[model samples]
Target: MILPIVAYGHPILRTIAKDIAPDYPELNQLIADMWETMYYSNGVGLAAPQINRDIRIFVVDSKQIFENMEPGEKNEYPGDEGIREVFINAHIKTLNGDDWPYNEGCLSIPKIREDVYRPEEVTLEYVDENFESKVATFTGITARVILHEYDHIEGKLFIDHIKPLKRKLLKSKLDDISKGKVKVDYRMMFAK
Candidate 1:
């Protein structure tokens, strides 16, 4: 099932998500549904909160980002090719390297894209879908997607990272999204 994504300004999006236990009911089904929802929305990443679930779970298949890149741009995002993973109960152990600005968008905030500065690499400790713990490092585009989705679980959005002036300019657009005035193909739940 592809759940309706909750739009910006929805209270659930602002609430910090909780870590789920191994016995969380229907965990496998929920992950599968999330993947379906993400692909249907043409999104590289989706957090549990985005799907109206306040839990520490996110799915990413950043390979789509690499596949659509121009031949000359392929090398620009090294180490991100064919990266796919499920992050649960994730903790960012380290955020290292210089800050780079990446054009970011969210399924919740339709029709809005902004350049958000983020670390180039991230070290994370997280559990897989099966609740098996693992520690890993990611860089380039893969890191960018991970960091973006991680923010959802932390009650933060990509727009929150932009300059105050830019964010101020987007206030009306953000309000439109909250009131369900934005156009989006996939289903979305709005605050209004």
Candidate 2:
């Protein structure tokens, strides 16, 4: 099912999501619907908050399967073993490195892209859809995707990662969004 995506300035987007507790009813179904919504919307990742659910959960498939394939390629593989990963009540433990810059964008921020610095790699511990505990290390695009979605669980947006000057320039536009004066163009903004 295609769920309505919450836009920038939505109160839920700025509020920290509550942690998912064990034995939550319909947790499995919720995760499944999140995956369905993500694929239907052509999004590589979707956070619970983005769907107006304030829970520390998100879905990610960052192997570029949603993007166009190169010529002569019969089949495109996302390469990540777990194509659709569900992170619940997640926490990160930095494994190494200080920080590195990477260009980032958000599903909520439509048409905006900017460079943000974050840990190049990280060790994450979280519960799976079945509430099974797990831990793993991630790097590169996968790491980037994880970090991006993780921010949503904490009431943070990618725009907050931009330089002060850039953020200042965008303040008015953000204000318009907060006031519901602008509509988000998801297709043009997220299509790769």
- Highest lDDT among the candidates is held by which one? 1
- Candidate 1 lDDT over residue span 97-140, tens digit each: 99999889999998999999999999999999878899999999
lDDT of each residue in 1-56, candidate 2, tens digit only: 56767777777888888886888878888888888877776678999988889999
Please name the candidate that would achieve the greatest TM-score relative to the true structure: 1
Model 1 whole-model lDDT (C-alpha atoms): 0.93
Give residue 87's error in model 2 in angstroms: 0.8
- What is the Cα-based TM-score of model 1? 0.98
Off by over 4 Å in 1: none
Measured against the true structure, the TM-scores of the candidates, in listed sequence, are 0.98, 0.82
For model 1, what is the alpha-carbon lDDT of residue 161? 97
Q: List the residue pairs that clash in candidate 2.
A: none
